[model samples]
Target chain A: MREIAAVFLSTVRMNFRDRRSLIFMILFPIVLTLILGTALSSVSGSSDTAEKLDSRAALINQDHGAMAGRMEKFFRSPEIRKIVHTKTYRSLSTAKADLKKQKLDAIIVINKGFTQAVENGSSKKLDFITSGDMESSLIKNITQSYLQRINAYRAAAAFAPQPAAPLLADHALSINGKIPRSSDYYAVTMLIMIILYASAYGLNVVREMNLSPIGYRIRSLPVRQINYLIGKTLGQLATVFLQIIVLVTFFKFIYHANFGSNLPFIFLVCFLLGFIIILLSIALALLFSYKMADTILDLAIPVATFLAGGYVKLSILDTNPIAVALNSWLPNAVAQNLVFQNIYGGTGQTAAGGVLKLTLIALAILLLTIAALRRNNHADLSK
Target chain B: MIIEVNDLIKRYKDFLAIDHLNLTIGDGELFGLLGPNGAGKTTLVNAILGLTAVDHGTINVFGEALSTSERAIKKQIGLVPQDIAVYPELTAQENVTLFGKLFGLRGEALRKGVADALEFTGLTDIRNKKPSQFSGGMKRRLNIACAIVHKPRLIIMDEPTVGIDPQSRNYILESVKKLNDMHCTVIYISHYMEEVASICTRIAIVDKGRIIAKGTQEELGRLIEDDQVVSVGVTAPDYSIIEKLKRLPAVKDATVDGHTIRIVLSERKLNAVLDTFLEEDLTITKIETNTPTLEDVFLTLTGRALREGAQ
Candidate 1:
């Protein structure tokens, strides 16, 4: 442990001394966030000027059930009223006609048997009719996400092991109608981009520790190889956390971006994401030679950025059967959504889901790294 | 014995790196492993350091077998590799301190050890300077300092002076002698014969992954004791004269350069070989007959110059 600590301190000191690369790692993300956010906001002008949706929406309550009435009440509440101007219409045909005539951006139809579907622990589909504009899709996603949470809780209750003990309570998050602004989304995406670049930094740290003569010197000492590797990893993690602290604080105070009321949770997600990035970097370094590992890290950042919606608001697997098959599970995408949902007050489950996903990735990468390191250790022994 | 290797063998893929090697170094001996490039000098050092596993052998260091007591054994040994192994980003002090810590030194002891190592290497005034800014000689000294900061019972230096100015090389050689005086066993590896001859108490000439000869300078020189080397400096030498000298019954080998012909013959045949050079009508400006040195011993054993790569 002492040897590990020594190596850790030494590696951290070296990283701090390398002022040029350190500056690049810390400054690049914040600058890109500002530039991208400003450019996106300008391109996507306000509703009045862009001829986009005006938040005027209509609702048709076909199921005269209690659940349907509750849904109607939610749409009419002042909380949702901030984002949506909704009017309950008697006829679905009239609401559809109004939506077509541009009087309403979208029409929400509470499907028949919606109340029974909720009470009987069955699924209910909410029909979201729209002209497929960005605002309409945003509203649909928000409403659908809320309903999905309710369904999840119901399913948990139904699957409870005992009669008296229930798994979850009937809970609905108060719709603040405060979606993440362009700055907030951009902040989170930029954060992902920055963290993904941690892989590059990680590769460099590992390369220095493994490929360089310094590594041979260390190996010749009493220090174990495992301790050396662990120390280097901790050093890289420290730098990443430092970058995160700077970027997060900058976004919070300077841009006034909302990361929910839970700052610790935001940090938790960031730390997990950082772990994933560092592990990936180490794993790649161990698996490939120096030049090949460098090539992979250089190529991975931009590709991961694009897939995680850093360049545009489109996921790599936006809509396809493979989306479900693959979980559209890019590490950066999971990281971006983890922050995006928390900032916008989406489902709380997203936090747990993100933790689970990142933890699994971390575990997998760690195992591969361990295997590679062991291979290297054995090979060295044979030398 | 500080280190003992019995019939050690190390193969890289299909090539033998350490072929059935056996060696024993007594305590406080400044042993030298002399070899040219690609002569498996580093490989032998790696085996002794336990950096490489042997195919078949038993290595006992500090009276304990390496296979079971690697860390404990490693704690008793220090390695100064041929390459400059100090971290370029770290100051001389930090580099020494880091290695010192790896050897389980801490607190006041580590501080004192690092300071002592820096002072010993004559780097006290520039301990805070990074090795990247250091001259080649200073870097070499810093490399030695890092290895000795832990103060192990035995220190192994591999080619510590491959490329450096004469001043630094002299300083390093003096430091090695100083280390031996301090009762630390030193294994100095190098290809330079004169450097080893000057300092090493015992020398081992390695080639093609095997020790070809091992002894003191006087002891190894005796390998060619029965033969005499006659160096003749001639003007406008002809290749036909060398061939004629080889035809002499007592001449073992004859080779000529632009104006000099070196002949190895039976000690009794020196007068006869000299007469043949005169018969070839060679203008002998200089004639010197001397006993064989380590280089001649190497050539007699391997039929190649000591400075040429075995590969």
Candidate 2:
């Protein structure tokens, strides 16, 4: 036990002494999160203005009757007008040219037969043209809302019934009557990435085994192999734990990230996931031999992050077969999903199952690492 | 006995690295495993240290058989590898302390052990400096320091002076003697014949996975005829000069290369060859006769240079 403690403390001290490793593991994650988070939040908060909309869309109006005037007035309603600034174009060709130049998000064309088609109960096509994929979903939603309101007005006139304007209610799902903000998602993702990165760095402690001096010293000593490995793994866990704590504290105080009812639970999840990642890293390090441990870690961490839905939304995994497969097995994915679900009060059965799944995966990796170490021991002894 | 090896056999594929080797090293004996390269010196050391497994052998260290439980035996052993093995990233003191802990030393004991080892290696002043910042000699000394911190009862040094300045080599030699004097059983393994001759009390010369010779320096010296090496530096001579010198009965062999002639003669016939050479009017610019050394014994046994491996 004393020998193990000594090994653990020595590993920790060595890690702290390496400046590049400190920056790569502990500092880079926080810096990357701050840069990306601030940029995304600013973009999401900006309001759309007339100039912005004009640059994004082209409009053509051909309605001439009173009903057409009313429809146009409805399109000019503050809610719709605020989203898109319409421009009258003499021809569709000109609108298309601007769209081709990428100076517009879309071109809106209202045909001369639109009002006549509505009166005669015939459908008319509203053409929208754009070279960009952005704002397509928002444009579609607003167009549907406009058509619904117009249909309601027509029914009121035809039935001689007094009808009230359709009311838009805030029916978004909430957890305990409080909706989750974007910051919550950011915090969970950032925590997972940071913890994984830190663990990856700490896992490289095994690389010291390749040092002939260290190898000779250990081989010549009375320390057990299992005790040495456990000491190293414990040291890595300590490093990851400290990094997660600092990151979580920074998230709460500096970034103002929302931590829901299960803050301690989230931290626990992070710790467990960190342990899994550290074990996986150790297995990988042993598999490739300690000589290439750092290189494998460099390649594996980013790839693992990508598979865990680090850069993109987790929903995107549905369309990515590899990501879907990895997400099911990845400890980081499981832990992140669990934390996100807990924050949103989402009762996902899969989320509940993740805790057990990740723990088993971590155990499997640790077993594989021990097996690798044993094999290495035999090989060295043979040499 | 501190270490005993009985009928040890190590086979790699079809080649035997150690064959039917039997040896015993008593406690406090500064034993030397002397051999040229590829003589199984390292393999024997590795077997003793449990770093390599012997095919058919029984090794007992400190009364414990060489098995899993032999870890206790390791606590009494210190190994200074042929290669410089100190951690480049760690200071000399840290390296010592780390290895000391492995031997069950801790706290003030660990600290004092590290300091004592460093001071013994003449590296106490540079204890706080990393090996990367150290000179080659300093690094080699630190490597030895790390191995000896726990003051193991048995210390195994494998070619500890392979590549270093003369001063450092001398320092290491002195330290080895000091360790032996302090009652540590030292196993000094080296290819340098002179090094083994100077420090080893009982020397074993391994050749081709077998002990060709094992005895004190004088005992091994007596195996070969006490021939004296005679060299005479002269101006470039004709081929007949070498032919004529070879015909001298007192001269066992003669070779003339470049501007010098080398001759080996029995100690009793040294003056007879000198008189013959002078009477023959052979230009004797310079001549000197020296007693046989370990190199001569190795050459006499293997019929080749000491550095060449035995076939």
Candidate 1 — which pairs collide? A383-B52
Residue lDDT tens for model 1, A1-383 = 88778888887788778887677766787788777767656654641211232467788888999978877887777666766678888888998888788887777888888888788765466676776554564555456655755565676777844222111121122122445566676777788788887786678766766777777777787778888888888887887887788888888898776666777777877888888888887777778876787788788778777655576653123333454233336777676767666666554334686779878888888898889888778866443
Instruction: Tell me the DockQ of each model, to 2 decimals.
Output: 0.51, 0.51
TM-score of each: 0.82, 0.74
Candidate 1 chain B lowest-lDDT run of ten: B265-274
The residue-level lDDT of candidate 1 at B230 comes to: 81
The residue ranges of model 2 lying beyond 4 angstroms of the native Cα positions read: A34-191, A194-206, A255-263, A291-298, A314-316, A342-352, B88-90, B106-112, B231-287, B303-311
Each model's C-alpha lDDT? 0.77, 0.71
* Colliding pairs, model 2: A56-A105
List model 2 lDDT by residue over B80-177, tens digit each. 98888866667888888888988898779888898899999988888888998988888889889988999989999999998899999999999999
Model 1 is docked with a DockQ of 0.51
Error of 2 at B220 (Å): 1.9
